[model samples]
Target: MGTEKKEIVGMIRGCIKTVTCGQKLDLNHKSQNDVVKPLYTKLAYVLGLRVSPFHRRQGIGFKLVKMMEEWFRQNGAEYSYIATENDNQASVNLFTGKCGYSEFRTPSILVNPVYAHRVNVSRRVTVIKLEPVDAETLYRIRFSTTEFFPRDIDSVLNNKLSLGTFVAVPRGSCYGSGSGSWPGSAKFLEYPPESWAVLSVWNCKDSFLLEVRGASRLRRVVAKTTRVVDKTLPFLKLPSIPSVFEPFGLHFMYGIGGEGPRAVKMVKSLCAHAHNLAKAGGCGVVAAEVAGEDPLRRGIPHWKVLSCDEDLWCIKRLGDDYSDGVVGDWTKSPPGVSIFVDPREF
Candidate 1:
């Protein structure tokens, strides 16, 4: 009876990795030819390992990890990987030491709280929802060379969970429309505006619920008080509803790229548009991941309290014959300017 607790003790989860074409990924931050040669390989991601406190030291966690790896192997995965906070030494040691893995990409997590008050979409910025075809065209035309870009981009865009890709351009570029809505995305793309940015939104809330644990009592109280004061005194105007300490949903922004001097401003407007979408859907926060040195980092909305600067991702090759050829030993590659966070992966 003392051998185990009356609860689920250990667990681990795995998902297919983001697929890539055979050609080399260009990290130069320059646009590339739209042609992509298809190549198929099995790469999977493993994460969300947990073991009950009372069941520690019994090797339950190790067993779970091993089982997941075997499942990946059975599914024809050539490589498997995992991720954790850079500062989480326990996770690092467990993955890199006990398990056979090596240090990989170090991407930053940017999270911005959704304010109860709607963000004002700039009048000068006209954000239009691009049809799926147009969005894919834009991505291929501009960001096909981005690192870690998903090979099945069309499927991701068509996924119901995706709200839709959006484009932000100068309002002056929108001709003959008072509401500033442009439906003919194809024609518009043919003769594009002077400046523009494109991004897509995915509803992450449908995947799982998130809660903040291990916070000071004072912090919780202060957060609760703010929410209450806002509700009790509407005129006072509160920042956001519901403390993140409680279970909350999230909206993820991806494929953020643009051109021209006003690119950054367009990104901000899209962020505002994203925030509004998140708030309407009852999501408490918006999150995005990009290279640590991305120039666009200064433009995206994010809060320090809910963000992680150096998120560590680790990987391991399951077999020796697995050829990375054009991809190279990504574990050895330097961080690039932009990293495409596939909506399907998030």
Candidate 2:
């Protein structure tokens, strides 16, 4: 966990002070997105804040966030997000409570095998494991059809801190419908042994969307791919069927955009598909991290409340020399955020 340090500064009563920002960077060992794209560059998602209690209530927190916003903006960040627990009153108050940041979506950081039996077996969708080359087309389709987090595809692809990357394609489509499939398949990039983080990027259908209006040619392509993965990786756990309010599930992580009628439906279908994989594999859970201000939260209030844990939302200025400041105790091992999906499956 090498600390990638950045700086953030604040003004209190007209006096300037600085804070240190750091994050642990790694590759998503299970990422499904990296199968097709070449690596580029990306910033780390973790940011820490160290502020003094004596300086509390001086609007320093707001200043810190503003500074970080400016830094990301200047660095070509399309959008940046932070995570925190639902019950941490201070953190909750600071972000949505006081900082005026809106709630995005609620996602569970679920643990697997804890409640494997609770998973409903009837809601399975097919998932296909795609060769890196075939998966790239799905990646392009995901990019063209939706607005993804981190905004830039290159940055998301290039980031060192990711899990495994994988892609889901339709069962029979030679190519996606949006663009005719290109010749030549992508090969999986080999990583060094002992890599803890795996990046898995998947080109999946908006299952929830398909159930509503009807599946498109492109959607069918993704569905087919998902079917294949489900058959191959029986060890992964899946999310449950979504209701009207909780109409979406963890599948939104591969959503085209944050939220829409189509996006919601796509996510729903994805949940069904993932569930099938878990059942076949006998896996227990899945996890998803959602921004506090994500629009997807409009329907699922429980997810919003549960996702908040002990994680603090901290910000600092760039290029300011400073030591690490502490906002809240991160060492206490606050209540673990409960992810609805099994970790083993991811």
Candidate 3:
């Protein structure tokens, strides 16, 4: 029941960085804070929040968030968090200042354009579609311990929006061959290939219609020009970003990670595979959100201009268990290997 404010790594609204952490907070700059990871605790994420235009400046949003937090506390949730764009100052202030939810993470939302030409998957890499059960088992084994992983992965993998889960591995290394029961996590990880990557694809085309408004004329010109040039000259392989000016669909790839030297190769191939899938489905973009420090960020292909380099996440503790009197705040502890960006939140 203690409402203490503390800064971690992600996003929160404030009076802005000039508001004081002993330094000016710059949304454009990446945070250098150590990873403050989870210990498999109970938590809830806030999403789909909106207020009527008539409710503006009436402290309605703040009250609503407080009420939700009370509900979370009543339900025994140990923590609650909110995610928003870094440039959204109003949202930042509402949470970080008024609501006492300090910054938690600065993950980037990586967005890749779906070009007219298909992105090629490497020949040496074999892409395999996974059964939902098998995919669930694998996720639990690997990512269940990571941040932002859903409470129930089975529901996510089985949801209609989830296209399927896929794994990229060196060719001739198919593990799930026979029609036997899923062998659980240990066996799946047992004798794994030297290099491998796994990810799930979620179709966001139907749920959200996103458009980029008020773009500078030059940016618009560049986006349009790139599309035209790419379409007109198929072999040129231009680095054209997606045209987000109009409403567009997005395919979100989540639970991404890999091992071994060629793991990066597998991830890139999987991204290309995802790009091809999105293009065929008429989605304008293939997207993902990864912790800024996750090496996977370097592997996933995306356009810099089209992506949000520093989207923020803010978290509040429902109780005082998050702190240890002897060692300072647990929020400043080292983070996990990678953050599990649950597409369900989007």
Best by TM-score: 1
Candidate 1 to truth, TM: 0.82
- Per-residue lDDT of 247 in model 2: 27
Q: Of models 2 and 3, which has the larger TM-score?
A: 3
Where does model 3 exceed 4 Å of error? Answer: 1-39, 52-55, 172-188, 216-222, 320-332
lDDT of 1 by residue, 1-346 (tens): 4676566888888886545423543455456654444333457887588888888878787788889998988877777878788998978988898888898778889999887667888899877887788788777666766766776788889888899898888887763244645646556667777888888999999998799889899988888887777667766555754668889999999999888888888999999999999989999899998878888877897878779998888888776545445455555666667778776666
Model 3 lDDT per residue over 153-182, tens place: 888899999999988878746543433423
Q: Which ten residues in a row have the lowest lDDT in candidate 1?
A: 20-29
TM-score of each: 0.82, 0.35, 0.80
Model 3, clash count? 10
List model 2 lDDT by residue over 1-346, tens digit each.
8999965443311111111112222355466554332212122232444467666677787777666666665654323345555565665676566544544334444211112223332222222334443434434433322212222433333334222233223323342222434233322222111111111332122222122235466755654555455545636733232211212223323322222343333333434444445344333223344333444333222343333323333322233221322323221222222211112112
Residue pairs with colliding backbones in model 1 are: none
Better by lDDT, candidate 3 or 2 = 3
Local distance difference test values of all predictions, in order: 0.78, 0.34, 0.75
Residue 233 in model 3: lDDT: 86
Best by lDDT: 1
